[model samples]
Target: MELLEERIRRDGVVKAGGVLKVDAFLNHQMDIELFSQMAEEWKRLFAGKPINKILTIEASGIGIAAVVAHHFGVPVVFAKKTQSINLDGTMYSTRIQSFTHNRIYDVIVSTRFLGPDDHVLIIDDFLANGCALRGLLEICESAGATVEGIGIAIEKGFQPGGDELREAGYDLQSLAIVEAMDPATGAIEFRS
Candidate 1:
């Protein structure tokens, strides 16, 4: 986690409107080495849990989730933002608003992949308002699956999402929690 915090401090960009762009390394153009390291951290942190599956929203989260699934020796299931022709059957669906894209997406997952027998570990790139994760949680609920834990690469501590999830009794582990950010100064403060 310290490695991730250091990377954010060195490479993360701060923009106005409370946006922190980590696409250079975390999302857009990924650092597999960094991701592998992060997966190891999460694997250690969530040890002893019955985590049989890794769930994530499509796009940015898929890469992280895949790497994590490899470390956990579990299959990764990503919720698609749009239903495709290849997908057919009973599906668990929900609506999620993207904080970065500023749009609503109808997210879905095939029922065949997840069920009541699965013990899931939800993984995502970031957590701000918690909309995407909330949607994934809804799908898990609909499937009657047990949520073992939630692993996040970065979390905005100033935001209410992480706190709300924690208050709800979720084992949410965020590698880097940004306590505050200054757009003008390009300064980022991480929670200790």
Candidate 2:
């Protein structure tokens, strides 16, 4: 977690409207070694949880989820941003508003991948407004799958997303939590 916080401090950029861009190491060009370290930390956090599958939303979440799944020894299931023609009729869908892109997407997951018996761990690259996390939770609920835990690469502590989940009694772990950011100064404050 300290390594991730340090990486964010070193490479993360602060933009207007409270946006913290971590594309250099996280969202865009990934640091696989750093990701592996984060995955190991997550494995330690959810050590005793019955994590049968790893679920995530597409685009940014796939790579981190894949790496985390490797540590869990489970298959990764990413919710599609758009329903492709090859996708079958049986699917669970939810609408999610993106804090970064400022758009809503219909996130879909195949029914075959999730079911009542599954104990899922939801993984994502960032948590801001909590909309995507809420949407993923809805999809898990639709399939009757239990969400054992939620793992995030970075969480904006200034935002209410992570706090809401923690208040709701969910086991959530974030590698780096940015408490504040100023675009003008390019200063980022990480939660200790």
Q: How many residue pairs clash in each candidate?
A: 0, 0
Error of 2 at 121 (Å): 0.5
Worst 10 residues of 2 by lDDT: 80-89
Q: How accurate is candidate 1 locally (lDDT)?
A: 0.93
TM-score for each of the candidates: 0.96, 0.95
For residues 124-162, what per-residue lDDT tens digits would candidate 1 score against the true structure?
999998999999999999999999999999999999999
lDDT per model, in order?
0.93, 0.90
Each candidate: RMSD: 1.8, 1.8
On the 0 to 100 scale, the lDDT of residue 103 in model 2 is: 80
